[model samples]
Target: MLVREIMTTRVVSVEPSSTVKDAALLMNRHNIGAVPVVDGGSVRGMLTDRDIVLRCVAENRDASTLKVSDICSHGAVTVSPSQNVSEAINLMATEQVRRLPVVDNGRIVGMLSFADIAREKAGMEIAEAISDISMP
Candidate 1:
């Protein structure tokens, strides 16, 4: 199967200049754990709930005052819509990431996540990928 076959198409993104609080609000509203940070039509980074907690909240920095770029993880691993699901899974394991931003022709298109993979019920592959991603 291909990434586009399982990736979530209704993805939400935030600008680098967006406030962490605003990003967090979007996450909350969407019931998602992360959002890709885009700048000038390119992905600059990814902001996750954990980043807000550890980098901003736990650090005692005001979310309203901080930009998503200030706390988001940079150089995020990405996948193309045409890529095979197995290749995408390998990337998730190698990168220790549970989600990947799907880009097409340099444009943010969708998001590939464990939940999407789970729907495939690929069994051992998913288990192994989860184990690798969970490694400390």
Candidate 2:
């Protein structure tokens, strides 16, 4: 299987200039944990719930005044939609990331999460990848 086959095509993305509070609200509304930060159709980074908590709340920063780009993980590791699922899984483990943006021709195409892989009946692989990603 390929990444595009399992990736969530209806991705909800945010702009870098978007406030952290706005991003958090968006995530909450979508019932998602993260959102890809995009600029001109190119991925800039990823703003995750963890980022908001650790980087913003923990630091006592104002979420409403803070920009997603300020707290988001920059240079996010991305995967090609055409890439094999196994390869994408390996990359996730190596990068210690639970999600990856699926890009096609330099444009944001979709998102691939552990849930997406797990839904594909990759129980063992998903377990191992989660373990790897959870490692500090």
Model 2 Cα lDDT, one tens digit per residue, 53-133: 999999999999999999999998999999999999899999988899999999999999877887685677775776466
Candidate 1 residue runs with Cα over 4 Å from true position = 122-136
RMSD of 1: 4.1
Candidate of highest lDDT: 2
Q: Rate residue 60 of model 2 by lDDT.
A: 99
Q: Which stretches of model 2 miss by more than 4 angstroms?
A: 123-136
**Which residue pairs overlap in candidate 2's backbone?**
none
lDDT value for model 1: 0.88
lDDT of each: 0.88, 0.90
